[model samples]
Target: MKINFDKYHGCGNDFIIINNLSNTFPKDSENQIKKICNRRFGIGADGLILINYNDKFPFEMIYYNSDGKISTMCGNGGRCVMHYCYSNDIIDNKSEFLACDGIHHGIINDDYVKVSMSDVNGYEKYNDYLFLNTGSPHLVKFVDDVSSLDLINISRNIQKSNRFDNGVNVNLVSRKNDNLYEIRTYERGVEDETLSCGTGAVASALALNILSLINSKTVNLDTKGGLLTVDFNKSNSKYTDIHLSGKVKKVFTGILEL
Candidate 1:
């Protein structure tokens, strides 16, 4: 079978997006999914996204990590899929879709897509690090120098430390200024350092806010891949109106044979 897919990216995070509205893709075939994401043998990507038809919403987003596993919500993936929906007329400039996390709303602004993330009720603090789930579970720590840290080894160690049984996306962030921060993330499902991570970015920003490290409600994040912005409203320790925005582009369309 030949699977037609489109490639898209938000910042540097890329995905293989397929239109699964007709249910043509065999989602149960984990091996096939893994093959399709193989960098050398298939369409290389950080993850795969399926835009499925939904009765309650405009569409449903089903995301899978490149490892061929159904993972948690992805912020960058959400933005890219929303951009895909807009570009393909699956939605207008704005849309509402159901994802693994819950219902999410998104809007397209030229090349930039803004996605409204779910509210975060609380977080756990361990020494200088903070842990929270912003669509996906994340462990956030503010470092003195983000670029100088040994990201892979450190993140890998903590992920396997059994501190988080389900594992967590680890984010190393450094305050660049009052409203801006630099971040490097080791995503859980991908099990590697990605160019950028949407949920990780949100978790890092919220963690900074919770620690009173930032004076602005809107936080700017610079990753190895590109720049992303997160805006939110906090009330009674609950974060609402959460929006993650960044540049997204459709790279190409291709057919993968299996």
Candidate 2:
């Protein structure tokens, strides 16, 4: 099979986006999906996204991890797929779509894309870390220096703990100011530190808000890949209208043979 794919990235969290409107792409071949996502031997990406037709929404977003498992909602993947939809005239600048988590709305302004994320209703706090789900589960920890920590080992140990089930995306956050933070994330499905993680950023920002570390409703995050901005509204211990925004761009387009 020869598949036409376009690569896109938001703050360096890359994905291979395919227009599967005709349902031509093979959805059951996990090994083939994994091979295509291989860094050394295939078209490298953190995940793959399929833009499929939907009855209620403009389209449907089906996402897979680098391991080729149909995974939970990916914030960066959502933004990149929105970009693809807009560029392909499938949708306008602002649109709503269905993802793995739920319905999400996105607005595109030039190179910037802002997607609404799922509302978080619960939190788990440990002495040194915090846990929350922002579309995907994340473990947030504060570190003096994010650049110096060994993410793989730390995340692996935490993933093994009874506190976490299966695995969790681990985020190391450093406070730059009341409204600014620096984050480095080890994503579970990717199984390593990614340059940036949209959901992880959202988890970290909301965690900081709950800790009263952030004074502003809009939080600015600096990740190793680039910058992301998260804005939200809090009322009576509930968070809503949460939006994640960042710059997304098309990296390239190619044909992959299987």
Best model number under TM-score: 1
Residue 98, candidate 1: how far off, in angstroms? 0.3
Lowest summed lDDT across 10 adjacent residues in model 1 is found at 159-168
Candidate 1 Cα errors over 4 Å, as ranges: none
lDDT of 1 at 11: 90
Number of backbone-clashing residue pairs for each candidate, in the order shown: 0, 0
Instruction: Determine the backbone clash count of candidate 1.
Output: 0
**Over 4 Å off, model 2:** none
- For model 2 the local lDDT of residue 139 reads 86
TM-score of each: 0.97, 0.97
Candidate 1 per-residue lDDT, tens place, 1-258, comes to: 887899998998999999999888874877777888888998889999999988899899999998898889999999999998898889999888999999999999999999999999999986568989999988899989998989999888887776787778889999887777999999877889999999999999999999898879999999988999999999988999999999999999998787
Pairs that collide, model 1 = none
